[model samples]
Target: MAELQFREAIKQAIDEEMESDENVFIMGEEVAEYNGAYKVTEGLLDKYGFRRVIDTPISELGFAGIGVGAAMNGLRPIVEFMTFNFAVLAADQIINHASKARYMLGGQVSTPIVFRGANASAGQLGATHSVAYDSMYAMFPGLKVIYTSEPEDAKGLLKSAIRDDDPVLFMESEQMYGLKGEVTEEEDFTIPIGKGKIKREGDDVTVVATGKMYHIAQNAAKELAKDGVECEIIDPRTIKPLDIEMIIESIKKTNRCVVVDESHPFGGLASEVGFLIQREAFDYLDAPVQRVTLPDVNAPFSKPLFDLWLPDAKNVVEAVNTVTYRK
Candidate 1:
């Protein structure tokens, strides 16, 4: 195992995949000459040359469409949106064309493309820029949604996303790029999609968290441990095709659940997970499932207001306590 920052793990994944597969290439604004918006593609332009490491105009829709076409024609393209907030401009291509091509054509064609970038609020980024699109994209069929929280998971899952024969929406966090974690040095490392990992083991309550929210859940778990509450934290690395079975297994052991998500409360990942827990593990549950998520309002730009709006460890701790019926 090797320690790598979250961004470095992502870069290593792309580097390894592109090195082995000539069909693999990457394109997005500032991806080449500018070394990527977050420097995740730094040095890739020189390593792979302009043909494979490409930079395009500031048009998300145009380049995204090109990426879909390239994938349909046999090239595996990784399309980066500076931030998913900007990807809203290209939703027509991603949701309509790329996602439907395989199904509508009766599996005659495979859109083996990966669309990735930072997602959700990164500090004071206001309403429009802070929207978490994980649940939104996961709702559509023919698309795979992977939101990673750890460096190792980011590296392994991305490699799988690139190799998948379907469209994948990979969501990362702007604030977590600097996070460091141990990643495997194994060659061709790839984690299977739709598999959830138990980050921490416990028996008192099951805490399901994803992306940046996983860290918040971790902090909450640590605090709860002081009062004898043990939380088994499960990170659903893939949002769509959720690993509900693993979650159900955890719930059977714990009999309580608290889902922490960065998305808003209504129609969010937490909503779906909470529903599934009640449906599949209803008999095992000892209490109602609780959720810690952004309220039903746009992100606030004001620092204090944003802090209030954002769900944090305190919020997760409260939710966990609620599910566990603790004071």
Candidate 2:
């Protein structure tokens, strides 16, 4: 294993995939000439050249449709959105074409594409730039959504997504690009989609988190540990084909659950998890499932207001305390 930043791990995965498959190519704004909005594609243009690591104009719809066409014609395309907020403009291609092409064409075409970019809050980006649209995208039938938290998971899952036959919505965090963690140096490491990992094991309560919120859950678990509240933290690395079984197993063990997600409270990942828990493991639950999520309103521009608006360790700890009956 080698210590690598989250962005570095992603770069390695894309580089390795492009090296292995001639059909695999990456395209998006600033990807080729400017590296990437987050620099995840830094040095990739030089390594892969302009033909493979192509850059497009600032037209999400136009380029996204081009990617769908490429995927339909046998190429595997990785379309980076800069941020998923811009993906709204490409909804027609993503939802109507890229996702439904196989079914629409009676299996004559396959959209082996990965639409990836930063998600959720990234330090005062305001409402337009800070939405976590994973749950919304998960509503579509053909798309596989992944919200990775760590460097290792990011690398492995990205490699898998690039190779998958279906369209995958790969969401990252602008805040976590520089976070460092140990990642495997293997040339072909891949993590299965729809698998969750238990980051911390404890019997007191189960905390399910994804993406940036997973880090908050870890910090909250540590603080709760000091207070004699042993919290088990599970990262549902993939959001759409959620690893509900892992979460159910952890919930069965702990008998209490607190789901944390960066999305809005209504129709968020936490809501889906909470609903699934009650349905699949209701008898095992000792208390009602709690959720920690962003407020229902738009993301605030003010620092203090944004801090209050976004979900954090404090919110998680409080939810855990309430479920544990320590409040």
Candidate 3:
């Protein structure tokens, strides 16, 4: 019943998890005395001390490797990147190593590691630093991905990810960090990894969204309501091991679906949802599944261009119309 900004809720999640589990520690760029690049780690160094809240050099691979190795050795490590764009430098460690090590070793080892921080276009951050890549991370089977679109869900999801027995990728949006929402006062609150929650119930169409796009879909549903179009907004919450059953159930009821995601249409969340829908619920669809996604090009630097590239209310409305057989 407490109101907290996205960043505050995240900070509380990390602080609480670390205090309760001595094996859990944070290692990231500027996480120590500097209090993290986004200040998500603010005041943590003083409370937990430097050893537990380490500020690493600008070496994503080095720190990521250390975190994975530590997790294998029985410590829970939260490794943060300044932004996920910079995580490319650590891909070898994340994709080939951290993501596959457990399976490669025949399940003899468990990596309780959480690689987190901002993902997606943040203002004028440009092509090099912008773009949502949680969908990209889903290619690795051993990695569990958790992305939340709100402050409260972010806290609940991140806490769940950190406490899990496997490697987790907690994708967040830098733009949503300052946003505020009422977070629960309960410490035992933890969201499951492969569940979907319908934020709105409607009959005309189902809009499946994740991360920051969930809020955009909510707004789009509101706008569509004005035009006498009903939209059901569902958040997959966790991309991998996706709640395909829940989505199928929704589509079976609505007979139409529109997927809204910030990632590109090709080989992204949109495509995955579309694939699942056709495979499991094609007979139930009244119209084709329409996906509103970013253009399959690098994220642009210009503000207007950036706006055009990301999923928005206009795109959602258009997709809703498309799937509902409207112009």
Candidate 4:
């Protein structure tokens, strides 16, 4: 195992995949001469040259369409949007074209493309920039959504996403780029998609979270532990092809559940997970499943307001308490 920052792990994944496959290439704004918006592709341009490490005009729709076309022609392209909020401009290409091409054509064509970059609120970025599109993209078929929390999971899952023969929306956080964690140095390390991991084990309650919310759940779990309210934490690395079975099993053991999602409450990941838990593990549950999520309101630009709007450890703890029937 090797300790690396979250951004470094992502860079390593891209570097390894590109090294192994000549057809693999990455393109986006500031990805070449500017060394990427977050420096995730810092040295890749020099390592792979301009042909493979490309920089494009500030047009998400244009470059994203090019990436889809490239993938259709047998080139595996990694398209990076400076921020996923900007990706709305390319939704037609991603959702309509890349996602439908394979099924519509009956497997005759495969869009092996990866669209990735920072996601959700990074700190008072405001309403338009703070939206979490994970659930929205996951609702569609033929598209894979992977939102990673840890460095190791990011590296492993990203490598798998690059090699996957479908359109993958890889979500990351701008705030988590500096987080450090141990990642395996094994050759071709890849974590399977749609597999949820038990991040912290406990028997009192099951807490499901992903992306930035996973860390908040972790902190809540620690706090809950102090009062003998053991909270088990599950991180569903892939939002699509969700590892709901694993979550059901956990709820069976704990008999209580609390889901924390950074997205809005309406039709969010927590909503889906809550519904599934009730359907599959209803007999085993001791109390109603609870959720901690951003209220159905646009993100505010004010720092203090943003802090209030964002779900935190306290919010998760309260949800856990509700589910566990703790006073």
Give the alpha-carbon lDDT of every model: 0.95, 0.94, 0.89, 0.94
On lDDT, the candidate that comes out on top is: 1
Model 1, span 1-327: residue lDDT tens: 999999999999999999999999999999999999999999999999999999999999999999999999999999999999999999999999999999899989999999999999998878999999999999999999999999999999999999999999999999999999999988888999999999899999999999999998999899999989899999999999899999999999999999999998999999999999888989998999998999999999999999999999999888877877775
In terms of lDDT, which candidate is stronger, 1 or 2? 1
For residues 1-327, what per-residue lDDT tens digits would candidate 4 score against the true structure?
899999999999999999999999999999999999999999998899999999999999999999999999999999999999999999999999999999999889999999999999899778999989999999999999999999999999999999999999999988999999999999889999889899899999999999989999999889889999988899999999899999998987999998899999899998999898888989999999898999989999999889999999999888877877764
lDDT of 2 by residue, 1-327 (tens): 899999999999999999999999999999998999899999999888999999999999999999999999999999999999999999999999988999989998889999999987798888899999999999999999999999999999999999999999999999999999999888699999989899999999999998889999999999999999999999989998999999999988999999998988898888899999989999999999999988889988999998899888999999999999999
The ten-residue window of minimal lDDT in model 2 covers 118-127
lDDT of 3 by residue, 1-327 (tens): 899998998998898899899999999889998888888999999898988999899999999999989999999999999999999999898898888888889999988899999998888877888878899998888988888888778888888999999889998889889999998998577787788788899999999998788889999999999989999889988888788998999888999999888887789999988998999998999999998888879988888887888778888898888888788
Candidate order by lDDT, highest to lowest?
1, 4, 2, 3
In model 3, where is the ten-residue run with the lowest total lDDT?
187-196
**Cα miss at 270, model 4 (Å)?**
0.7
- Which sections of candidate 4 miss by over 4 Å? none
**Greater-lDDT candidate between 1 and 3:** 1
Residue pairs with backbone overlap in model 3: none
Supply every candidate's count of residue pairs whose N, Cα or C atoms clash at under 3 angstroms: 0, 0, 0, 0
Clashing pairs in 1: none
Q: What lDDT is reached at residue 186 by model 1?
A: 88
Q: Give the TM-score of candidate 1.
A: 0.99
Candidate 3, lDDT over the whole model: 0.89
